[model samples]
Structures are given as C-alpha cells and as structure tokens.
Target: MTPDLVLYGYWRSSAAYRVRIALNLKGLAYESQPVHLVRDGGEQHGADYRALNPQELVPCLVDGGQVFTQSMAIIEYLDETRPTPPLLPADPAGRARVRALSQLVACDVHPLGNLRVLQHLVTQFHAEDAAKGVWSRHWIGEGFRALEAMLAGNVATGRFCHGDTPSMADACLAPQVYNAVRWKLPLDDFPTIQRIYAACQALEAFQQAAPEAQSDAPAAS
Candidate 1:
C-alpha cells in the first residue's frame, strides 16, 4: 500500500509551519489540507478534526496507516524515516543541544502565547489587545534572551542553529521569530536569533513556508 502523508494544518500556525519546514527539508511531497482555526468558532475543535486527533491540534501527519500529532514528534518521525537529509546531529550531545534549543521555543514559549491561551487571556482575563501584545512580547523576550545567551556564549553556534546546514533548531527558531515580529516585539536584544533568522530566510524552503507566502494567511501583510 502506498503511504499517505496528509498534513491537516493552518497556514499561519507556527506549529504547522515548523512541520512544513521539516517536510521541505526532507524533500517530501504530501497533501496539504488546510484546517481553518478561527472561522466558524474554531474548526479544529470540530468533531471531524477531533476524530483524527483527540488533542485537536493542527499539523497532524497521516502516514503509513498511523496518525502523528505534535509538531516536534512529526518532524522527528520524518527525520527518522527519511534519514538522507538528517535533521538531528551525529553525536548524542549535539542532538540534545538542538532538541533543547527547539523545546525552549516550542514547549516553553509557544504554549504561553498560542492562539487558545491568548484568546483566554483576552476573553477570560479581560486582556485588551495591548495587554495581549505585551504578554506575547514578554514570553518571547524571555525565551529569546535565554536562547541568545546560549547561542552567543557557546561554541555550538554556527551558520545554522547546530551547524552550517539547517537543523531542527533553525526550523524552530524561524517560526518563533516570525511570531515575535507579528506581535511587534523588538528584535534588537537577540542578535544571534536575528542572525540565524536572516540565514534561514535566505533559503527557499523557509521563505516559502513564511506566513505571508501561505494561502491561508491574513491580508494584513
């Protein structure tokens, strides 16, 4: 049986964007099924999407008679299955460093500023747009500060997050930086992140995965 790799995701979603970068890095061709996040009160929470992923998260990868959720997990699965273009490091220590960097953005910063969390801050906590922007900027700054310190103060820093070539950390960093720009956060503090972002943006893969280049992204850009 031929394997099916359909990504059910929204274009502007950072998590989904990360998976898109990984797929492009691996040079895999798959079906893109856009799941609108906000229209009709969150279609991701609809019964149909929930049937595929109970967690109701975007970027669900349907491959080889199995379903995979979580952006990091799906990306790692792709790296494992298609090892020609490796996403991790050859050494265990290097792999750990890359994963740590990626998680600092994905697990720590992303959850705090995700759509649902931000919406809750607005609707439940009565946070206005300015307050929400402050909230997003605060967490992004915190994560980027630590990430900059790690990158600038360590020898692991290279042309990309792990090396001269793009890696998982670079994929994670680009999307987070994009979100920070969206919320109007100043990038002057994180020189290393900005430098890495510039390098990643020069690549066709990252450029094509950008929110502005996607079909589902808003016209605000």
Candidate 2:
C-alpha cells in the first residue's frame, strides 16, 4: 500500500532541502506543506505547528498515521520502508561512512547557522546581516574543508559521495553547498565538493528539489 506522505517544511531550510533530495532520489511522490519559517515571526512557532512538532522545527514528515520529526530520521524511515534506490549503502561499513558524511553537514555545520541561531544572534546579540553571514560562512567553510579532505582523499568517492548514485550524503551535501553558495562562500578550494555538487544539481531529481522550484519560494528570490 502507498502511504500518504506530507512534508511540512520551509523552502529555504537546509534540513528540509536534504529531505526533498531524499524523496526525489527514492522516486517517492509526496505533497509539500510549506511552513513559512520567517513570515510574521515564524510560522513554525505558531500554536498549530508547534502542536504538530513540539520542537517547532521545520521539515517534519507526516507519513500515513505517523508524524516524524527531524530530517535524517525521516529520510532513514523512507529508505527502510521503500528500499529501492537505497539511500544508504548495502554494507554496514558503507552505511556508517555515509552517515558520518551526512552528519558532518546536518549535525555540525547546519546547527551553528540554523534559523533560530541566526535569529537569536540578531534578537539577543544584535548581530547584523554581515555578522550573520560571517557566522554562517565560518562553520560552512570549516566543515566543507574537512568534507573536501574526506572526499578528495578517499577512493570511496565516486560520481556521488559514496558511489555513482546519489546517497544520503549527497542529499545532505547538496543543500549545505547550496547554502554556502547563497552566502557567497568560495567553493574553489573544495574542488571535489564543487564537482560533486555540480553533478548532483545537474540531475532532474535534484533540480526539481531545489529551493527555487518550491511553491513556497519567494516571488523574487
């Protein structure tokens, strides 16, 4: 049976972006419910959305009768349930490596530049746009540097992060690099990551999952 799948996400969210890539890669058809994270003091903080996700986070996936929060968890759930065009590799070691790469962006780089953290910087610490960009670029660059080394040095890296086909790591990497480019961070030094990103973006799945292609995407953005 095909379960009803609805993704509640903000168009610009890196977490949500990763999930979008995952859904496309798995050839899953799902409805997108846009959560405007920055409109009118954030829709995610509203009573209804918060009730749906106590964490008040974007990128919650409602699958059939189950409500799932967190992008990585939702992605893994999709992989486990669907099983074709697998997001994780077949072997345990390969899966671990992919997961490690995924976490490099999702867990480490992303959190430091999360919407709330950026909002807090402005509201609590009075950080300007320049400062926020600096904060975002710093972590993104540092993380990408390590990721570049991992990919450039490893024989495991193929057309994608793991092999020729896109995996969870590619899903995670595509969005973070998108954010990096948005922030005007240089990708010249990370040639391997840049090359991988270009390859991922060229695919129809990734192109369709792009932020600009979302219904909730801004009129001018």
Candidate 3:
C-alpha cells in the first residue's frame, strides 16, 4: 500500500531532517525518496526534480499531488493536517516563540553552513577544507550562542524546546545540533541546548528520523 505522503530529501540535509522528524512525530507513514545531493553533481539539479521544486532544494513534500517546499512550511502543513500531537502551541504567544526558535536555526544559522554555500566557498573563493571548517564552526557557534541564551532565559522551555512536548522547534533544533557535532563545534557552552538535545535523542521518533538511520546513508563498516 502506498502512503499518501512522499518526501524527497537527502539523508544528511538538515532541512529534510526537520521534515522527517515532523512526520515521525505525527506518526504519518510516508515513502522516502532519496535525492542524492552530491552524486553526479546533484540529482536535485536534474530536470525532473527541478520541475517538482524549482529551487532544487531537498525536503520537498508531495501530498495528494500538491507539492510543498521549505522545511518549516512542510512541518506546519503536517501540523495543520494532523492536529493530534500538535507541533505548534495553542496560544499565539507560544506559537510565535516556537516559530522564532525554529527560525533561529533554520533561517539564521543553517544557511551559512549549507552544502551549496560550503561548496561555493571552495569553487568560488578557493577555501580549503580547514578554512571551510573554520567558517562553518564560526557561524554555528555564533548561532548556538544566541540560541543558548534564548532557551536558558525563557521560562517556557521545558523537557523539550516547548512545554515538555516535542514541538517544531525541537525538530529544527535536533538537526542543527547534528551539524554542530559534525563540524566539531564545542557544545559545552550551550548546556540548555545539550540538555534538550539529550531529551530529544531519547525519543523514538527522533531516533528513527536521524540521518544515520536514513536508507540512503552509507552503511557503517
């Protein structure tokens, strides 16, 4: 039987990781269609995928022939369609806070460290791997510094990014944490984030949605 939802994404893409977490949280079954971002210079650049998403970005969700782009938008759509186990808070203020937190990572942070941007650093500016690592760590650390403050100062924070339930913010957060670890950015400065990340990792949904667990990820030796 075919699931109503189909997700197009690469295994390690933070954007796609957010969507995958959302789907798992909602307990929605979906077919995973792997888009190899680096193989043969990116399958996303091919004609068919570009037709589906002109932006040629991963984490494009196709539902009943309607295609949705952007990780945040896709997660919100899922929340709207499947109200149980809601991703956003009920109150307007809470929703705003969650959105703000989510955007802090998805918008302000992730873009600087995105694959294309890193590739462009090499192809355009001749940045070596060490230079690229420095660039990524700098931006990720900058973002994490702000994120740590926000989460630590806010009373709304709980076991998760929001009132103990795994909200959209956590979905956005987990991937950024993964990126931070991948870039070898020291996480000791952000205790709140570390705590929340530990909480998130304990969840089955997050575990299932992890990059290493994705079908397209290379098998361990």
Candidate 4:
C-alpha cells in the first residue's frame, strides 16, 4: 500500500526516533525511508534528499504536497493536525512547561551529543572514538541531572514528563534516553528519568518507534 505519510531518517537517529514516536502516538500511518547517515558518505547529503531538506537533516515529514523539517516542528504539526488525543495541554502554562521540558533535552542536551558533532570532534579536533563517547556521555549526564531534578521536584510531573499522558516532552525524552542506553551512560542517580523511560518504553507507540524495531536497524542490536 502506498503510504499516506513519508519519513526520511536514519535508523538510530534520536531526532527521527522522536518523530516516529509522535506519529505512532497520533495513530498516523507512515512509511519509513532510511537515509543511512554513515553509509555512502551520508545519504542525507545527497542531491535528491537535499531537494527535500536543504539542511540534510533526518525525519522530514512529507504529507502530500506539504513537507516538514525538524523533529519538533513535525511533531507539533501532527499534534495540531490531529487533536483527538492532544499532545500538548490546553492551558498556556501547561503547554509552556511541556515545551520547556522538551527543549531541555532537545536543545540543551542533544546538540552537544548529536552524531555529526561527535564525528566532527573526532575528525576535526583529532579526538579518539573513546573521547567522542565521553563527550556524549558527559553532556547527557549533565542534562539528565537537571531533568531528574525538574521532574522530581515539580508537582506537575506525573507518570510522564508533563502529566499522566505522554506529551511532546516524553517524545523528545525517550529518544535521548535511547542514546544514553547505547552509550552506557549511568542513570543510577536519575531515578525520575529512569522511571519515565521505563514507563514510556512500555507503551506500544514508543516500542514501535524504537531503533531495534526499525526496518533499517543493523543486525544484532
């Protein structure tokens, strides 16, 4: 069957993972087109994919004539277009809190540990692969420390990041937690994050969006 929606992404890309989770949560049917970030010198940089996204980023959503870039924007678009379940809160304060939690990881933590940045650290700065892993771990740990405090300290936090239901924050967070797991970053001190990760993973949406379940994921994951 021809897909109603299409997503371009690499298997393990955190940003792509976020979009997949959001699409799943919204019960939106979509097709996955893998853009191997490491193979053939990065398929996202190719002319064809570049035509779709000049930034060469993953998780570009194409629905008919419309094309959406950036994971957060696409997820928000989904939330706006499909309001049955509603990812954001109706209240302005609640929406702001959800967005802040989402940005805390997506902006503050993810940038320091993104794949391209890690590759650049090795290629440009002459850092070893181990050093690159350390860099990722360090930033993730720092961000989780703050996230832990925020989630644990706030009364607004519930089963998920914002409230009982999954929000944009949970969609943003689950992917970063996957990255942390891959890097073997310690989460002993961040019990709140650990609990949330466990809860999110239990859901079908998060499960189907996981890298191991993706069609393009490498064998023996």
Candidate 5:
C-alpha cells in the first residue's frame, strides 16, 4: 500500500535534499511542504512545526501517520520498504563503506557547516561574511581533501563513491558538493570528488533535488 508521504523541509537544506533524492530514486511520490528556516524567525521553531518535530529541524518525513526526523533514518526506512533501488550495498562490507562515506559528509562536514551553525557564528559570535566564508572553506577543504584521497587512493572507489552505481554515498556527496559551490570553494584539488559530483548531477534525481530548482529558492542574484 502506498503511504501518505509529506516531507516538511526547507529548499536549501542538505538533509531535506537527501530525502528528496531517496524518494525520487525509489520512484515514490511525496508532497514537498516547504518549511522556510529563516523567514519570520524560522518557521521550524513555530508551535505548529514544533508539534511535528520537537527538535525543529528540516526534512521531517511523515509516512503512514508516523513522523520521522533525520534524513538518514527516513532514507533507511524507505530503503527497507522499497528495496528495489537500494541505497546501501548488498554485502555488509560494501554497505559499511557506503555509510562511512555518507557520514564523512553528513556527520563530519555538514554539522560544522550547516545554515544554523553559520547563522550562529554570525549572530552570536559577531562573525562577518568573510569570517563565515573562511569557516566554510576551512572545514570543506579539510573534509573534501580527505574524501578525495579516499576516493582516489582506494581501489574500492569506482565511478561513484562506492561502486559504479549511485548509493547513499552519492546522495550525501551531491549536497556537500552543492555547499562547496555555494561557498566558492576551489574544486580543482579534489578531482575525484568533482568527477563523482558531475556524474551524480547527470542523474535526474540529483537535478530535481538541487536547491536552485526548488520551489522556495530565492530569485537568483
């Protein structure tokens, strides 16, 4: 049975983009309920949204009357139910490798560089735009440099982060790459990551989830 899937997410959120990619990859249709994180003092903090997700984070997935937070958890639930367009690998080792790569971006890089964190640095710490950009580049460069080595030096790395097929790693990588571009980070150093990102962009799923293409995207500067 097809469940009622409503994704409460912000257009620019990488976490929300992950779930968007997963849904498209699985050929599942879902309602994209835009939750503006900045406008009107962050709609996510409002009583209505907080009722849905106490943590008040974007990319909240409501499936079959059950609300799920965390992009990875929501993607795993979709994978468990669908299983055709598998996000993880069939083998345990391969799955672990994929998850590791995914975490390299999601856990390590994203946490330090998300929108909320950037806002905090600027508002709370009185950081200027230049300082925020520096913060972004510092972490992205460190993370991408490490990822480039992993992808290029390791034999397991194929066309994608794992094997030839796109997996959870690709889902994670694409968003981080987008963030890198937004911050104007040099991609020349990480050729392998650039290559993988280009490959992922070729797919319709990634294109659809791109922040610029989202309904809530601000008019281009």
Candidate 6:
C-alpha cells in the first residue's frame, strides 16, 4: 500500500527523530525519504529540497500535498488532525508545561549541539572534534540538570513526561538523551530522566523511531 505521508529527514537528526516518534505514536504510515546531511555537502542544500524547506533542515513532512517544516509544529499539526492520542494535554496548564519541557531541550539545549553549529565551531573557531564533544556535553548536561529537577518535582510527571502516556515532551526528550549518550555525557545525576527514558524505550513507538532502526542508518558492525 502506498503511504500518503512522506517524511524527508536524516537518520540521526534529533529534530527529525522527534517527528518520527510522533508519527509512530499516532500510528501513521509514512515513506522515509532520507536526506544525507553529511554526504555531498548535505542533500538538504539541494535546489529541490530547499524548495520544500527553505531552512534546509530535515524532518520535512508532506501530508495531503501540503508541506510542513519544524518538528514541533509538525507534531502539533498531527495532534490537531488526528487527536485520537493527544500529544499535548486536555488542560491549559498541562499543555503549557509540556510545551515548556519540549522547548527546554529543543530550543535551549539541542541548538547548541546542532550539526551546523558544531560545523561552524570548526570552521569559524577552529574547534576540534574533542572541543565540539565538550561543547555538546556541557550544554546537554546543563539542560538535563534543569529537566531532571522539573520532572522530579512535578507530580504530573508519571511514566512519561506527563501522566502515564507519552507526550510531545517525551518525543522531544528521547532524542536529546540520544545526543547525550552520543557525547558520552554521564546520566548519573538525572535519575528521573533516566527512568522516563527507559520507560519510553520500552514502548514500540520509541523503539521503531530509534535512529539505529531507521532505513538510512548504517549497517551494524
């Protein structure tokens, strides 16, 4: 069967990973259109893809002939259109909390460690891979410290980021945690985050959305 939805993304992009998790959680069928971010100076920069997303970023979703960019926006669109399994929450306060948590990672932390930012660090500032790793770890750790406090203190945080079911916050979190592990950041200080991440991983939605499980991911050694 042909899928009506198409997702253009790089396998390892955290932003793209968030969209993948959201799609899986919604039980939506989509075709993976891999855009190699590293090879050939990034296929995202190509004329065709840039037309779809002027920002030259991944996780561009095409649904019913309409194009959508930005991971968070796309997730919310899905939620609004589907609504069977809500990504936000029913109450206004809960919705705000989830969005705040999502942005804590997406806006505050993930941007510092983004591929383009790390590349600029190398080109403009002569940063080595070790320096980039350090940079990533520092920002991720700072964010996780705050995230841990928020999740730990909040009674709303249950098995997932909010209540028992996973929400947009969890969709945002799992990817950042993946980045933390990639940078070799220690998880000892974030027991709540670690626990929630473990819970997310046990779900089929997160399992299928993992970077390693993506079609564009390299073959296991």
lDDT of 1 at 190: 88
In angstroms, the error of model 3 at 129 is: 0.3
Q: Candidate 1 residues 162-183, lDDT tens each?
A: 8888999998999999999999
Off by over 4 Å in 2: 1-3
Tens digits of per-residue lDDT, candidate 3, 105-217, equal 99999999999999999999999999999999999999999999999999999999998999999999999999999999999999999999999999999999999999999
Every model's TM-score: 0.96, 0.97, 0.99, 0.97, 0.96, 0.99
- Per the 3 Å backbone cut-off, how many clashing residue pairs does candidate 5 have? 0
Q: Flag regions of model 3 displaced more than 4 Å.
A: none
Error of 1 at 107 (Å): 0.8
User: Which lDDT values do the candidates have, in the order given?
Assistant: 0.90, 0.93, 0.96, 0.91, 0.90, 0.96
Model 1 earns a TM-score of 0.96
Give the candidates in order of lDDT, highest first: 6, 3, 2, 4, 1, 5
lDDT of 3: 0.96
Per-candidate clashes come to 0, 0, 0, 0, 0, 0
Question: How does candidate 5 score on lDDT?
Answer: 0.90
CA RMSD, predictions in order: 1.6, 1.3, 0.8, 1.0, 1.5, 0.7
For model 4, what is the error of residue 69's alpha carbon versus the real structure, in angstroms, after optimal superposition? 0.4
Q: Which candidate, 2 or 4, has the higher lDDT?
A: 2
Worst 10 residues of 6 by lDDT: 212-221
Candidate 4: tens digits of C-alpha lDDT, residues 75-152: 889888888688999999999999999999989999899878988897889999899889999999999999999899
Looking at model 6, residue 132 earns an lDDT score of: 98
Q: Between which residue pairs do clashes occur in model 2?
A: none
Can you tell me which runs of candidate 5 are displaced by over 4 Å? Answer: 1-3
Where does the lowest 10-residue lDDT sum fall in candidate 1?
A: 1-10
Supply the TM-score for candidate 6: 0.99
- How far residue 122's Cα lies from its native spot in candidate 3, in Å, is 1.1
Q: Give model 2's clash tally.
A: 0
